[model samples]
Target: MNTNLSNDNEFENDAESRIETEVSSEVESTPEESGAEENLIEENISTSETAVSPTSAEITTPIEDNEAAGEVKEVKTASAATSNNQGMSAMAKGLAVIAVILAIGAGLVFWKMKVGTHGESLNRVTAEDMQIILKDANPMQLKALAESPEQKKKISENIAQLLAVASQARKDGLADEPIVKQELENIRAVVTASIYDQEINKDKGPMPQFGYISEDQVKEFWNDTSHEAEFQKFIDSKLTLARESGKFPKDKELTEEELKQAKDDFAKIMIYAEEAKEKGRDLGEDFNREVELQVKLQQAQFLAGRYAQKVLADKVKVTDEDVAKYIAEHPEYDTKEKKAKAEQILSRAKAGEDFAKLANEFSQDPGNKSPSGELQGGIYKDVPKGQMMPAFEQAALALESGQIADNLVETPYGYHIIKLEKKGEGKDANGQPTQTYDVRHILITTTVKDPTNPMGREIPVTESVKAKLAEEKQKQVLDEIVANNPVEVAEDFTVPQPSQEDLQQMQQQMQQQMPSRMQPPPAGDIEPPNSQEPKKPQPRQ
Candidate 1:
């Protein structure tokens, strides 16, 4: 039996050895399968080693794998949540900024449109103010305002009335009329032009070089001129009656001082009168014929003055009784006549004797020579009341007829050596007596040179120089303005042109309004309207 058991054991050992050999051969033949099997074995080994227990090992392997997978999924979800939150926050901020900008922009646009649309309604004006504003407006601007037919009709009706009222206002001394003001300006321009010519032109008179000239030349010129001689003769004739009546000194050659005064007075009158004449002539030329109208206007003025004088003539008569009555009424005009009388030492004055010395040497009055020499004239006539200084009037009043003032009288004009002549009376329009007197005058004068034309030659400026300078300056200013400013013109533009359709319509309308013959023929027709017939369209070739 022992022998039989030994044999069975040997057979089992042999079977186990054969099984091992078979497994080794299979691994060598299939390498990929071997590697996969080995990896599975390693995982199983690791799982087994980390297992808390045999059952735990089996459960933890799959549980741990599932936990790792769940953790990765949770991380991805958190990251996505954070990214979405950040995107939403940025969107909210963007929306807020857009809202604020839109609000401001909308408000500005609304305000601008409101102001622009209501500009005229916010500022109202009245009729008087409108008239004043429109008076000086250009024709185009006025036409724009009165665009409608009704407004234009109202303007036309009021314009004539307004002009008439404006004229009346001017006559009453108001100076607001544009037309009147323009006329006055034109007159002034003419006067200025005349003055320029007189000053610059050498042929008009004795051209002044510098300072003043004495009256000797003036007297000589006057005596040589026939017109002036005639005027002098007329003046002398008027004065002859006064001399014969012992009312004035005898006729004699005027002294150098007297001649000088007369020349100065004449020069002033001539200058002003010539200026007036020139201005009048300019106006006349712009209106009626030049010289004739100006002369007629002067004659009209003279006639008007004569008429006024005649109307007031009865009021200005004088008589001896009236003079006596005046003297009785005013004690100042009546005083004891001075017995002192002496010849004037005029020769001594001209012979280099001091004026004061000669005045004192002539011993006609008790007054000092200083005051006497300073006095300008011996008598005053045709002077308004209260014109003389109080002291001067008092001194003069104290003197009697034919009596000189004891002391020279100082007045605003100058110093005066007064002699009380005969007192007289005049009558007004009512024939009531008034104070009057006949007086005569002697004058001396001096002349002064014009500085603008020292050489007394005319300086002529040509039109070319004025035009060139004006054009250059204008171009310079225009270039500067254009350089500093930028302007844009619209892309699509065209000069206005009449359309063929418009011309045809206009012609048709004209034909409809007129008889066939009265209507205008075709544009190029040279034949008379009565001789022409309407041409028919020719057939196309």
Candidate 2:
């Protein structure tokens, strides 16, 4: 019986030892054996976000299973709360930034509406005030004009009238006209564009005194298809303004090649303007001022022109009878008497008369005289074809040596009694033979001087003269309007005159720049870098 009890105890001890060994093996398994099981546990934990807690059945160690599971859950909850707080903080920062931007915008609007009143008032347009509107206006030019009190007053009066007319036009709803609106827009765009180009090139070393657009930029702009519509609008506006000024033919149209050349010539200005807008360069102070000046100038001019055409046409119309009356008052403007005088001289020259004697006695052409204003026998040496007027050049070219033109040749300046002294040939700078002629002629002066000029000296009757004549009548009308409106010029807003030393320095600088100005510009296949072809329209006076 004792031996049987011993056998049973040994068997119990062996089974208990084997169970202990199996549990140890499961808990401390090799990485290679548990790799697949680890992957499944990781995926389950990520998807379900289930906190891993050891079940009572799995926990064989001395540690308390429920307490350990509770600790793990608390750690995860704290970490998640930290992440949520961070997200909320970031969202709050974004909202705060947006609110600040809105506040800044509101402040700007408020300042422009309230505080900007004095700056923009037209009732008192001062030189300092004009500086805001005409920022790019040459300081030297203003100083020069201000040197004369008369000039300063004239400027003030002109500006006042312009503002008054523009104001009236707005009230009349003329600003709403599509054509007028487009013209104002064109002026603003062009002036802004010009300012932008100048600013960018301000640091590029010495430039032309008047400034010039770059050729490479112009070429690039011509090829660009973008902004084509804007280009067309500008061209149209320029033409319309020109036509309104009565400076160009009513039926004028740009030729195909001319249009392309125009594009290249004006490309830098228009394209840079577009770029300035896109790049927000238009917000610059200089650009803004020039734009405002040009826009206001164009608007005023447009309104004034329309008013002159519609309202003052009959009141200011110069009749043939008026011209005759003017000629009677100023005998020097009598072209009919001058033409007869030219015919008489031409007959004598053709009637075996000594041409030089006739030219000395009868020629009134200032160019036909010496620097001392003495008649130089009206002899032009080696005259080129294009140097003379069409009728004068034609008559001279048709004549043989020592032969006089059969009839008096008429031109804007006067009637010419041309005597061909000799035909000649000359070599140009390129060493190419060029046709030239030497001629003796008596000129009968027919051009009328500006009635307003006290000197009444013989001067070219340019567009400026015509404008002055027109302005005389317009001024009468504007004076009445201004009397009613009553604008004021600021007393303290004075322009400083340069000292004599300053003037000398300016003259010396101009002299120094003469050589560079005379030098031929860099060559370009598209357009001359400085070409102002398809000439920009002049603003109305």
Candidate 3:
């Protein structure tokens, strides 16, 4: 019983020991497990820290039920960034479009303004404005006005003023004055007559076959006539006057000195004459033909003048008052005393008397001879102021009314003693006339030398060589004329005898003057069928 009891106690103690050992083992296992858990917790904390360091700590936290909200926030941020970028791009594009549109619009506006403004300014100008602009404008200014829009406005304003003045003058009835009417008529007549003469000359074909007036005929007439002798007589009388006036050399009795001077003068005259002849000769057949045409023209002019006088006689009316008015206006016209008397004076002056003394002695002027020198008469009413050379006009103007000027009035023609028998009112304070002379002069001119040919080719005869040859030829022509001279009685000269061909031409011309209906067709041509009752034969000459 005691052993059994002791074994139970040992078993109890072993069991307690085993339980304790097991508990200890369990505690150790718990420690190991706890250690393992600590290690794991430490590792997890380190990993979490590392992750938090690399990423956000908030990301490591578990998202709540508001994860969708976070996602929405993120989405909103992305959207905002995208919208901002898109907005910038859209703004950039909008600005570019606006800039292009504004630029194009500005260009269009500028172009329209420029075109419209220039067009309006141009339309405002008138023809008269244009004329004035053209008239007074300098070339550079005109170019600017033409090209630049700004300048054209100023040019148009200047021209309007001139037209106004011209219009006023016409409205004053100045255009209908008798003098104005006469002047207009004269201008019209001149223009019309020129046209008529041109037409008539055109109608007349080139001159007849004789190469202008038969040179043979001209030479014959010149030689047969006593005109040259008469002309020489007149020249001798002029020379005598010159001698008496002491214009010639003083050794009057044909002394050796006088003879020598005379010979020298004659030689000079002969030289001039020879030169004139040469010039006339060098004017070839064309010139001769022109001369014939001139003769015909002169004849035509005379006939036309007569016809014009008859046709226009009613238009020209003269009154005594008109004549008096004319004389009053033209003081140089014949004075009452001059018209009343025909007394002439020839003062006997000493040979070689001073020109002033001669003038004083012979002057018929009513004014004192102290300031007056040479005096004469026969000045026409239509004499011009400066037409007489400066010297003559100065002398004439210097004298008082009816006063003779000092010294002989030398001119291209000869010396003259100016007489102031009449006093007249002058247009100016100085006795100058207001009227401008419109005189028509017909010049019968002779040149000493022939002009150089247009082609620069040498003439058949040089100027120096022509004179002698021309004189010889003229003499030969004269001789031929004398041989062939023919005389016509007054009856025979009454009418010109036309040649057969000329008569035929005249008949044709008369026929042409008739209506076209009067003309007959050519003999070879057949008449149109049923055109006329009978075919007419060609008209006989």
Candidate 4:
């Protein structure tokens, strides 16, 4: 947080200090308003919903919208779970630096600058001036800071960064804003005070929570062992960001000489970082109480989360009996019966009639009518689960390539007099199993929604209600799981809200991140790229 220091062993080298900024940016907690926490949560929400999947390999299994082809891509893109108030809270109001864990990143270190107490020829910020700047430089505090000659000399060299922050704020259209100027002054003041506090008092109160986060309980739900691909993907993202941001050299890879220098810097950082961490853990009675509260709260949330998954996922079943019982209990569960009126078509196909020819002549799939009097049969090629209704999928799966069902398979859409053209087993690039079913079916549309009916429509048969029944039962099961697990927080703990100006500045900083937001924050947890409508759609497949 304290950006400037001179003649210090920990960050004596300018380049080392600049590199340290990357680690500093890795705070575990920021107030609810922080951009860093928001981004992290966005990336990790899928970690929860797919309790079966790791946060790393969030697979896409989209349910196609029959209304429009475009909606299929939209649903797949937005499949990640929402995480506004999940796992742990993000509010990390701190006296200084919001909240940073000693663990910066993989192989990175924390630099502890021993200042004020050391008797060396170096610049510093006076204790008095720091307080004045932080607390809006009151008349009395300003008068006292000016009168202290020794204190003034200590701060002469390091105060420029504070001035620069002010200058940057003005250039960004915040100069005329009195509240914005004061908030900037306050953040700088806190940073300066924290430095002096560390220098003068090694009594850092109590031992704070370990590494700012405990991953043990989270591991209970996310036990997937396949992460080698994820690790490489993570490394690739870092490398790409470096090139895109110009944070590292513009070349694709570091030069030999550059790599050597970086290695040496990394070595020095590791040594000093360990020392800083050791000192912080044993820094007397001034332990970070906020961190302790956050750790405890997170532990409790993880416990509840694990329990919910066990009950909802591990215990719940989707057997045929479950659906039957649900329908019996709630008459509304059985959607209008839709029977594929394909007795004549099935008989013709079984009587040595060409199945493809029969499908082209009799299939009633919507939007498949041809102007030339030729039937354009709608075909499902290399179909996966959830792309088609459960009954249709199961019936097709039971048949081998080139096999046709003797009886009609009923689904909510109607019925499928089906034929399996092909079946293949394969793995995607990420090494997950991919079952491809090239299925040919002539759908007979036998049901339509009607406002006149009590259940909002009328269907012809009970066998056709599989899809809607399955979806409703799944929701009911999840609702039951949440109802069973009671997650409670410490009643006494409360997070303070930010003021108008503070919230505005936080919002501004978030917008400045890559793909700068062109519009306001979304009502939902997910933030779309740049604007409500993305500039361009990048295909995930």
TM-score each candidate.
0.16, 0.42, 0.16, 0.32
Off by over 4 Å in 1: 1-228, 234-256, 263-295, 311-541
Regions more than 4 Å wrong, model 3: 1-384, 387-391, 421-503, 506-541
Instruction: State the lDDT of candidate 3 residue by residue for 18-48, as single tens digits.
Output: 2112212323323222221111101111111
Model 4 TM-score relative to the real fold: 0.32
Q: Model 4 off-target regions past 4 Å? A: 1-289, 309-319, 329-337, 340-376, 380-405, 410-414, 419-440, 444-496, 499-541
Q: What TM-score does structure 3 among the candidates reach?
A: 0.16
Per-residue lDDT of candidate 1, residues 220-250 (tens digit):
5466566365334323432342232222345
Predicted candidate 4 versus true structure: per-residue lDDT over 386-488, tens digit per residue: 4444566678889988788879876534567888888876554355788866666776764443322243223322222333443344345434432443222
Give the distance in Å from residue 521's predicted Cα in candidate 3 to where it truly belongs.
Answer: 43
Minimum summed lDDT over a 10-residue window in model 4 is located at 98-107
Q: When superposed on Cα atoms, how far off is each prediction in RMSD?
A: 62.7, 39.4, 65.7, 20.5
- Model 4 lDDT at residue 201: 44
lDDT of 2 by residue, 301-407 (tens): 44443443344445443334544454467644556777787788778887888888887887765555444556667776765444455566778899899888888
Tell me the lDDT of candidate 4. Answer: 0.34
C-alpha lDDT of all candidate models, in order: 0.27, 0.44, 0.26, 0.34
Tell me how many residue pairs clash in candidate 4.
Answer: 16
TM-score for predicted model 2 compared with the true structure = 0.42
Decide which is better by lDDT, 2 or 3: 2
Better lDDT candidate (3, 4): 4
| Candidate 1 TM-score, C-alpha based | 0.16
